[model samples]
Target: MTKSAAPSTEYPGLFSPHQEPLPGALDGELLYSWCARFHRLSGNSKASTTSQMLFGHATTGLRHDFPGQLGYFGAATGGHLGTLQEIVQARTQFALHALFLDESTRRATESVFQGNDRSQLSRTLGLSRSGQVSLTPLKACPACIGEDRGTVLTGWWRMDHQWPSMYACLKHRCLLNVMANQGRAHWLQEWYLPVELREDQWAEHTEMGQSQVERLIHIARWTEALLHQRDIYFDATLLRHVYLYQAKARGWMTWDGALRFATLRAAFADSHRGLEALPGWEFIKEVGSVNGGFLGLLLRKHPGRRHPLKHVLLMAFLYEEPLDFYAQYENSKLILETEGPAALDRRLTDMQSRLIEMVESEGKSANASCLELGIPTTQGLRLLTRKNVAVHRRPRILTDALKAELEALLRAGTERDEIARRLKLRKAYVKDYLATQPELRNAWEQAAKVQLAARYRAHFLRVLEDNPDVPIKRIRRIGGNGFEWLYRNDREWLAENLPGIWRRPET
Candidate 1:
């Protein structure tokens, strides 16, 4: 039967997310070619669209003015087009035009301002602080249309001079004294200047409050400075003082534990200087180490407790170390504790008992116990098979029609090959079947044994007959005494067993 189709979800995105695969679009060669092109283009330094070199005029030592430069600006009028030609003449003419226009516009704006009637000008034209008349461009230049076709130009007039004030404000001096002192006080002052704040309000605070805040800030600053020092003066001194105090109270802390806790505390505190610090194990160690102390008394009562406690301490160290180290240490500790001198003999005895139980319960031989301990299964099976008591049971061949046919064939004097072909059986099988019959099998065996003995006996007799003068003792010796032993044991029995072979000497 044909297999059922796989569920659609099993082939994710194959049919849905990307319809069926496009015949030629998914070609790997095409993708590789595109990738090559992209890499080449991206790495090319001389590509025109992204050239790194600057462009300038040699004579004037100024940036080169191209046709495209001012083409993006939309303010140039019909008269301004003529002014753009004649590079040197255009510059002078443009400056003159700007000066004349500025003076005229200034006079007009000043007359309006002195009139003190702001509503007339406000209705006709909005006046800015520096009173320059605003006019919208009737049409954009070709370059401006191409570059900014989709963009709004409402703030284009202010774009030229807008960045100057931002640059100036960057240099403005901050009035930080008005705020209360904070550690990194300059950072707070920088934050406050841009937002408008009254100086007088800051001066109204009591001098004592500011002094106290400054002193606290100074302390915080000093603490930070002490922490950053590599020589370890103040922090180490503080840790030593704390260490001595804990030691004096309980008199049990180890130097190593104290040093470890001090180091951990210093590193942790440095990262979180403004936060609360973690408690160390100095007190615990002190109590544990003191004579007649809580932990000390426990240890005194149980001398063996120190090893397990030390193992636990070592585990804590491993927990702080890498995972591989932790696993190695834990595994080693478990094996050590389980197989130590105190427990080795008992453990081995228990293992032997367990192995025996496993074999007995499973009805398997001792070899199966080796298999349970991860021995090769095939090797274990072979070992167990050798020990199997049932192996002595002889194979039983049942009498059937096939056996009767073979007997009939043997009675008819049929050749083994002819009998095998008639019964559609192998020659070996026919031979084996005939051999199972007691009378036929015994006759065949005796005949084969007699023939073998006769050949050797005939050779011996021929040697003796050829040399009649030879002594009987020497002749017998030459024939071998072992041959005589064989004749005495089986010669008469073989003659009686193979009467037909005796009658037909050739057979």
Candidate 2:
């Protein structure tokens, strides 16, 4: 239950001849929330009256995130709520969204917020397709309501609590309580506060595991940190460099700037596990390959406005802290400023050439070459491919020593294709050799089938282990080729190892 505050009785008309005192905004309170509070206190029968008086139009301040026409509101209030820029930075999510935008878009968005013809604000910032207040229910923190009661007279909606990325409150560390109504117009005409809502008006809280709760808190904190950073803005190109740099450190990208997307997806899936519970993060649940989803759009060389929340989510996953991400960005900016991108490209080309030399000339395995050069095996392989050097295929003709090695690997239960790769023989060559040696083929097939079944079984079980709550049917789609292989070859083992199918209860 929310604590209640008595409406003020002094100063009758808010915008009339009497000129009643307007309510001051609470710290971190939303601009729409401040106006709603005023409407309630002013005893205005129509919401339009308060809207017209404050923002010179009925719908100007209706949008919660980017309430346009701040100039009118600032003038109407006689500059009581501080400057227009001050109110926008302090009350709205402008600063948070600006952090991920380029300088031109950031300025355009800021201008829209302060200008008269401001209908293009959301589209300018790429928030027209967002899953924010328009799509979700109004959210309030129960713990925050109780805390706000002590500081202010009534419980008000918090700007940070309303973020699409924020499933939990940063200070409370608990899930936000959502209003029952999910419509965008839930508060359009009404002037009400969180304290005035009935018990039945709130939605049932979604239960989450302790780990999920902690993950939500971590993301919420990062969002709030970005929200408060009014002056900082990131360039899209610099951000891409920062991400690529970090990816290299984690062996998710090559020295020549080619991304090992499969490796990256697997690692990102692990890092981003359980974060899809928050709204707008549904895309993260289904990991996409290269050039697919938000990950692809963000890494690409473009001037598009990727959502700030997504940027923060990636930042949180890549770096230990926001400061660490900022430090990396600063490093990239410094490199670009001093050395320039051409020098960086040259340095990468030199590194790739060195890696090729180590693998092709020195006869070192790609993995061994990478380890010696302090890089990842994937990087070495990609670098070798970039140089058109096929170290594995150089000795194509099956020599006596190569045949012996391939046969030894086959007898040890290695898959034929893998044997082909390891010995630099073509896959077709391995297949043709198996066709002639019938008895050797039978033994190798039996051993390889068993090995493959076990390997895929482990992979399928690991997917289940990572996402225990996902339905088995959905798991089959996302669990990779292993699920299909297991279902076809070893149904009995898969059935025994897999958890029971998940189903929703009937209403």
Instruction: Looking at model 1, report the run of 10 residues with the lowest lDDT sum.
Output: 160-169
Once fitted onto the true fold, the runs of candidate 1 whose alpha carbons sit more than 4 angstroms away are 1-431, 479-482, 490-507
What pairs collide in candidate 2? none
After superposing candidate 2, which stretches have Cα over 4 Å from the reference? Answer: 1-18, 102-104, 115-119, 128-137, 185-187, 254-256, 270-277, 289-291, 343-350, 354-373, 376-507
For residues 1-507, what per-residue lDDT tens digits would candidate 1 score against the true structure?
Answer: 111122334323322213322222111111112212322334433322111110011111111111111211111111222222222112211111122123444234333322223344333222222122221111112232233335422101111011101100111111112223223322211112111224432333333333333332332222222222222111112222322223322223231122233333333233323211111112223332225222332223132212112222222222222223323434434554576633322322234444445555665544335434333333434544655422221123535976677676666556665665566454556678667787876654565566546665565456556656655434433412222333444567445653443343221
Instruction: Find the candidate with the highest lDDT and give its number.
Output: 2
lDDT of 1 at 179: 26
Each prediction's TM-score versus the true structure: 0.14, 0.64
Query: Across residues 267-372, which tens digit of lDDT does each residue of candidate 2 receive?
Result: 7777666666555567785566455467777776673666776787777667655656767777777888899976544433356767788777887766545555
Best model number under TM-score: 2
